[model samples]
Target: MAEAMPQTLLHEALQKHRAGDLVGAAPLYQQVLKLSPRHPDALHLLGFLLHQAGQSAEGLKLVNAAVATAPLHTDFRGNQARILLHLGREAEADKAFRAALIATPANPDALRDLAITRRDSGQVVAAAKLHARLLCLTPADPATLLAHSGNLIDLGRHDAASALLRKCLLLAPALIEAANSFAFLQITIRDLDLARDWFRRTLAAQPLYAAPHSGLAEVCFFENDLEACLRHSERALELTPDDPQIHVRHGFRLLAAGHVREGWQEFEWRLKRADRIRREGLPPRWQGEPLAGKRILVCAEEGVGDELLYASMIPDLIAAGASVVIECAPRLLSVFRRSFPGCAVHAYKREGDRFRPVHRYDWLPKDPPVDYAIDAGSLPSILRPDVASYAHQRPYLTADAERVAQMRDRLAALPPGPKLGFCWRSKEVAPFRNLYYTGLSDWRSLLTDPAIQVVSMQYGRGWREEIAAAQKAFGARLHVLEGVDMTDDFEDILALGVAVDAIVCPSTTLVWVGAGLGRPVMEFGVEPHFELMGTGKHPGFPTVRVFTRSLAQSWEAVTGAITDAVRTL
Candidate 1:
């Protein structure tokens, strides 16, 4: 076998590898390696083939040896970095990437590898900068554009990311990846109708791209069309059965729609997203008959509002004789700790000695170890909250006394009485979607009346632009809350709410908080959200005044109704 090798053997093997004929070139490459065990080219090429063949460890060893022997070889270093990345060896992969970059500064492949490694290592800003540099060298490169768009999204620059994707689509409308990004942004901005349009367009362009099917399934879920969600999710699973997110999505939709028994069983796929349940730090528990007297760790998922909404279920689980440990976000740590004073609570990501369990409830164990485990959403039904019983207790959140005093003093400086807090715009920024869900212009009508002082409780970008225009139109009526920096934190949000007479927001989580506070909340929007108002009255909060788009998504009519209501008040 060693004697059969010619100079062209390496070349022939390379050609076969390029043509995806790994089996055809295996014997020839073996012969070459047998004759010269130290050959860098043979080692590098075989390493790639071995990795492709699912022998990652051996492949990595061979690739590392090749790189050591040929330290300056760009191809060897790139291959080594990629194999490290495939195995999720972030630190080692970062070293290989830097080596490759030093060897080939202008190499687009190396730059891409470096960007991916940065992203994997949680250096997203650095990765975005590298991709931006790569895009300059290769402007039309789809991969570079995709990386940049994803980075932009992580930074919460959804509008910029969507713009880049739209440009990418215009350049190559058949680019399924770009279409997926476009569709995802639409969902984030609450443009489900437009998202459906994008998904249809992408599916038309590439019928085999199974990713968009998942998007379609989510859209169906949002619409409360469980039948369609199931159908689309099944279609997606047919195309990509191993996607855990798809399984979780399907399971959650099923659970939310009242098929709880099976939904919990199906929803266990969430553990597969990462190697372990890193957030909750609890072992996976299977679904079966609820075990009595078992120690359970009920893991919290999703946002802060979600944790609060679901914490009511703790008493029920306790009554079932299961001890509970609540794991949630750090900001919610103080709040949840206070709310669930009877039970133990901890921040989700902090690692420590594992909580010993009679039976763990985090994972979807096949035998269903513990007696009962449920998501936060299940708490509401388990403990049907009667508003009347909790009505007199008012103020679920406390305003920072100092911040409240500061705000009060500021408000006192302005023309006094009947202050209306306005949060017209939502954080979302897709022009059409934002306009549909947030009645920014609608609230502006009330701003011009001069009778009521408009306090700007609206946070996020683009508020300055709107305020600047409003100053030109309705000069003295607008009392913009100047120099008071607020965050997404509930403490800051509550402070603003406490300082106002009544809060007017466009169908946000703020509306929920206001209603919970027994404040007069004017909920305005151009279209319905979560079946809240088919015509009038919000299903979630009865106290909220519903002013929706009157005819064909008219913001004017909604705003007009709000002004008329305020005038009557």
Candidate 2:
């Protein structure tokens, strides 16, 4: 009779729980537990009800108890994992989920949640495998297709992603995520006109959707419609104020539009992104204050060119009377040491977005231990808030004097004409970046010119063969630096940069270094960059003149303008 009473009470409790009568179901579940202490169903149901009532911690305890009682119960395990995930215990949740999958290998819900967890943790490849497995089980499920499309996109399988998105839309036409992903796919293919129209249609279907607004902002940006881009960006920000990426892009637009102060403020949000690895156990960031009798750490960021660009502010920190420590690329360690004698420079590697010093053991005399740390890119936000603030900062880098003289003598021994440094392509050649660079063949006029000797400042492998091929193709007068590894030895590269008569490149380390040294440089760009600060020129770098060509023009057509400028030099 007692056993039957507990079973009857459990049935009543489950009915009340399903009906959302938590207050009435609680006492019945308690009575079931009092009579039948090991009732896994009662325990799990009570835990779920508690979880529903916003008591995840208490619910997790009950769920774990239920799982202990019935180890093979799929519902108990799944509910336990849910409570663990809700309590932010990811590792435990993963274990619980794995157990659930083992018990019921074909469970669609378990597979979907595990795949999403992998994706959220930046494990796209793992997520893709799980999504593939899920799709096999539920091939006709539209939600699975939508999720699998995102994984395919992240894996760079654009065609497969597009097909899946099409299938998803066909199955569920009103699904906003499928529509948004498909629209974003058009942008990835660089079909801006098609993408813009698609985004507009999406916005029409759901007028208040923030994603389409963000998509339109990106389209407007690539098309050079800065005004329209900013408007869309602002609208996206208004709709989804907590989005970090949107704020980061809006910051770039603000800086490109000349709103310097507001731009820097928005740019600070980049640190809050998931990809930006948070630096734990570090001192607080240095706000613009007197750093007298204190020490600070400046983390290296971005590429070598960006490092040189941001190094402009390190000298200012020293001038304001603080001892500064910097972690930079191994290639720039020797050069940075020579340039900033007052600061300690160490080699570093990037972990996601932040720089980690190879050796903090060699930090400057620990009379005062490091008190604050700041990203190199963040320095300008504190030191140079406006255009006028950049004026007082002088040309801050110096190449080795002896090496510079030796390189000058070596170059003088060439053909007695103006020797120019050239970088025809960026290291990362993608659809978005291809517009900024031209092939060596496009440098036809300059390469064939007998009047000037163009030194190959181009880094990376196969460049030697490319130069050799170019020379063979046209009998051109291009020379490689005989003794220097141009890619890894920035000290030697800086010496060569200082020795050259002029530098002509799209955008690279040499351009930033040339600008820092006030050397004459001609920068060929296809669109606006934030560093130009909406002026189409470097405000602090007068000798670095910018040259632009409309996107409609062929890159080969723009080389003649470069040749013309070189002739005058």
The lDDT of each candidate is: 0.68, 0.82
Give per-residue lDDT, candidate 2, residue 178.
86
lDDT against true structure, model 1: 0.68
lDDT: worst 10-residue window of model 2? 352-361
Deviating ranges (above 4 Å) for candidate 1? 1-31, 116-127, 142-201, 208-277, 283-302, 311-340, 343-417, 427-441, 460-469, 480-485, 488-501, 531-540, 550-552, 567-569
- Model 2 agreement with the true structure over 1-569: per-residue lDDT tens digits: 87699899999988998898999999999999988787888888888889989999898888888999989888888888888888888778888878989999998888888888777666678789999999999998999999999888766687899999999888888888788888888876668778877788788889888999989987787677889989999999999999998898899888888888878888888877765645545677788768987789988765788889999888788888888998888888888888888888888644432222122334434666788888888887888788878887678788889888989888888886789988887766554466577778888889888888888788877778888888889876788878776778777777888999899888877788888777889888766577777887887888898887765556765688888888887
Off by over 4 Å in 2: 1-11, 70-75, 102-106, 151-160, 348-366, 400-418, 435-452, 460-488
Tens-place lDDT digits, model 1, residues 67-150: 889999998999898888789887888889888889888888889889987876567788898998898889887667877998
Q: For model 1, how big is the CA root-mean-square deviation?
A: 6.9
